[model samples]
Target: MRGNRGAHRGSPDSGSVTDVVVVGGGQAGLAVGYHLRRQGLDFVILDAEAGPGGAWQHMWASLRLFSPADHSSLPGRLMPIQSGHTYPDAAHVVDYLADYEKRYDLPVQHGTRAEAVHRDGDRLLVEADSGAWRAKAVISAAGTWSRPFVPALPGRGVFAGRQLHTVNYRRPADFAGQRVIVVGGGNSGAQIAADLALDGDVDVTWTTQRPPRFLADDIDGRALFDAATARRRALDAGRDDTGGVASLGDIVAVPPVREARDSGRLKASPMFERLDRDGVRWADGTRASADAVIWCTGFRPALTHLAPLGLRGRRGHITTVGTRAADEPRLHLLGYGDWTGPASATLIGVGRPARDAAREIADLLDA
Candidate 1:
């Protein structure tokens, strides 16, 4: 059940133990794997997907990466560009991932879905549907979207419309000529709403419990990094280590809800107070009907596999940096922060942590 999709790692007897095993072969996983190679560390990357594209292939088809092509490339491969282009779409990004894997000769186990990861004494144990893995250390690059956040709204089941999460959203075809209500006011909400509205005939409406804070010219990005760094420093400085969830208020540098607002597509309504046969009711005595609901309500990091490690924050994220030295020492997390530099949670954003973690792993091995 957990074997690779295409290429296998030669014979089963040929497989050797690795210094580290990274779960989820997305941008973060690949980045870490590449760094580990440079560090002369033997490691393996386990990805659930059939290929190297990570979550990009599963995203909406019309989606073009918001970041530039130069920023999208992984550690080893150059993004293939045409005519000195600007931004690349999902397909281009997918191709770049394939090239990245090939160029680096990364030991990746595609189609191997890591079902569980827990501490087996000093070593770490990783279980996939197809096989079991034991490594000296584990890096969770699973990313947050693996577990979609769908709130327990009442009457969700009986609703007479199609309901989907942004992870499954491919294009506007399902929404064509339909009355759609996009839930949540995060970046996904804003982007999808704008796309649907621009396409016409969709009649998209966005709903949020609280007003989202947006930034112009990526001001929110700077603020988020500063806030996260400050918090991390505070923790290091003995300010407080109460295992609290980093507030979305701090890291959220969301794009302006301008398009949704200016185009009459946004609303400050709470989530489903009630779902009736006719439509959905909000907390503020408002009701709306829709043919589809796309929950851009964000995601929860799935650390279920790591549950036996007994490490978590107040909201259940693994609470550690560069191998949880103070708390769950020797456990590290990437793609789980509001970095204080140019990186956000995107592929480009994960490089810093990957580099740091790889260095730390090398040091540990040397020690």
Candidate 2:
């Protein structure tokens, strides 16, 4: 049941009290926690993960970061330069995140998944399967990895071949020597297609609704974040925004992907019109048999835990001023993407918005 109507802090009877309750324990959540601690706020990070690393642990084995370790990091700690890795792999990121938790000694409630957030006066109550948390502010940093998106293409159900989303994909050797269709336009699609292409045994048909956007070889997460930051600054200064990541493209041409693309082994095909019992069909009725389809379509914000608040607008987007929900100022959203802040989803990019959100929350709590 709802607790109160105005912006007065609530003294809920059943939950642990804190100044802030961060609803995720991933990169974004960690960033927010770091800033909140700096502000000296009493807070706890509710992480659904049993361990650390957030969603990085679930990525494909060969997945690499878009930037080098130095450029890809959260707020305080610089990710140690991995001895031999040019671009840190998923494992390395996991290690860094785990260490980050220990380094700061951030109070994180691991294995706790937030169930919902309801307003009780000005305070927010975060309901979790493990327990309940009552705080003056709630920062929802739940990232998108849990909610993989696969398009509902025509005849998808009839396709006899194996179909899986990115969550289900781990490595390419699993689909060895089979015809596989990888669908998506962004990095995941490109990377997975390249992964399959490198296998040599797999016949990979990479399809995207639009042509894949490939950033230049030199471009990495650092450049993208910097450009995005500049763009954000320009926009905030009331200047006309121009070239940034959009002009570059979505997919980063990491070495492996470059190898696959340059050699033509990872050539992208136009999206298939529909799935057939045994394969895919094109608009011209052209058909090709496929043994499997891997959808790298991407994901939506993992905000189901915040559903009780009734803050989402059309298409589940929560309108916000920075990270604060427009309709519910006590609730802030971080790291979902551009909607929260420029490049907020990336490790390097999450800092600014996290800092901003923490500062605002601190100010509100002080008031």
Candidate 3:
């Protein structure tokens, strides 16, 4: 703590007392590790998952990245081209991440879930299931996948049929022969609904609070991330800020989604007001029967591990400057979403902010 990145392997009981301890060994964590290794900081990455891949391993089977393999890689490495596919699917991503970790040899302790972070004298203590580590700086890359969010809709409890989220969905066959209502306007909602419509025997309805927004077919994660970068540059330079990715649209028309839309199978209805025991009712005196409701509503940050720091605002977000927590300079949050950095949630975009966070930590520790 006193001498900066003068880090060494530590006492047996307390784990490694390193210059930095990074939480979550996903794309963001690995990205941070790449830059931190460049800085030659002695650091360890703690990952909750049992192996490489992070949240990608748990995603629904039909999930696919909007960009091709070359366009959707982390820093210092290109994801090997997945053969026989234009867009990489979740399984391909898992394999790429596994290989990336091996190639870089980043120090990641898999299966170690961080429980809490507490200040200890001049250093910060990260307590995890495997052991505790005291470090000069801590980077919370613990991503949002563990914290899937669902709205508190009225009469939701009484719904008799299954209620699930995108996390619970695997493939279309799981919902075959059922009336499935997919909620939310985001990509997951669209993808899941389309999955059922195109691949399964399920009768599916897509619902959004407002009309769904789909980007032009040519637009993918690569183009969207570039737009986000340009918007951030304009804002930083005090120019009339151009719009970010949201201005483009919500859904990126990956092939299956494109097919569903072009075939008129992916039609979105207005969101229902409340749920009955076996169905949902619209505010407009309309009712429909449903076998199940899947809420693809998205997630909140998995920052409960950092709760002891007392930094989150009323809305459960840590106020950030660049990637560093505004209230706690020793702490940096990455990969939660745009709040941490524009497009940082995307596979390609997280690298820039991860690089920035690593540099800031290196400088802070050197100070």
TM-score of each: 0.82, 0.95, 0.96
In order, what lDDT does every prediction score? 0.68, 0.87, 0.89
Q: Write the per-residue lDDT of candidate 2 for residues 1-367, one digit (tens) a residue.
A: 2212112223333667777888889899898888887887878788899999899989899999999998998988999998888899999999999999888887777888888888888688888887777788899998998898887899999999999998888998899879999999889899999999998989999999988889888988888998888888888889998666897798999999999999989888899999989999999999889999998888999989888888788888999988899988788999999889999999999999999998998788767
Best-to-worst order by TM-score is 3, 2, 1
Query: Once model 3 is optimally superposed onto the true structure by TM-score, how far is the C-alpha of residue 142 displaced, in angstroms?
Result: 0.9
Error of 3 at 121 (Å): 1.5
How do the residues 1-367 of candidate 1 rate in per-residue lDDT, one tens digit apiece?
1213222243223333567888878788888888887887767888899988888878876566544666556666656674544557778888788778878887788888888776776777777777777767778778777889999988888888888999978776668888787787677876676667767668777667666545544443334444555666677788974332235341122232455456565554555686666578877878888888888888887677777767665777655544443365456676654421224256665676788888887777667
Provide the lDDT at 97 for model 2.
95
Highest-lDDT candidate: 3
* Regions of candidate 3 where Cα sits further than 4 Å from its true position: 1-12
Clashes of each: 3, 1, 0
lDDT of predicted model 2: 0.87
On residues 1-367, what C-alpha lDDT tens digit does candidate 3 reach at each position? 2333323445426565788889999999998888888887888889999999999999998898988899999999998888898899999999989988888888888888999999998889998887789888999999898999999999799899999987888988888799999998999999998989997599998999899999999998889988999888888899987888888999888888999999999999999999999899999979888999999999989999999999999999999999999988989999988888888988899999999998888788778
Query: Which window of 10 residues has the lowest lDDT sum in candidate 3?
Result: 1-10
Backbone clashes in model 3, listed as residue pairs: none
Clashing residue pairs in candidate 1 are 2-130, 117-305, 323-331
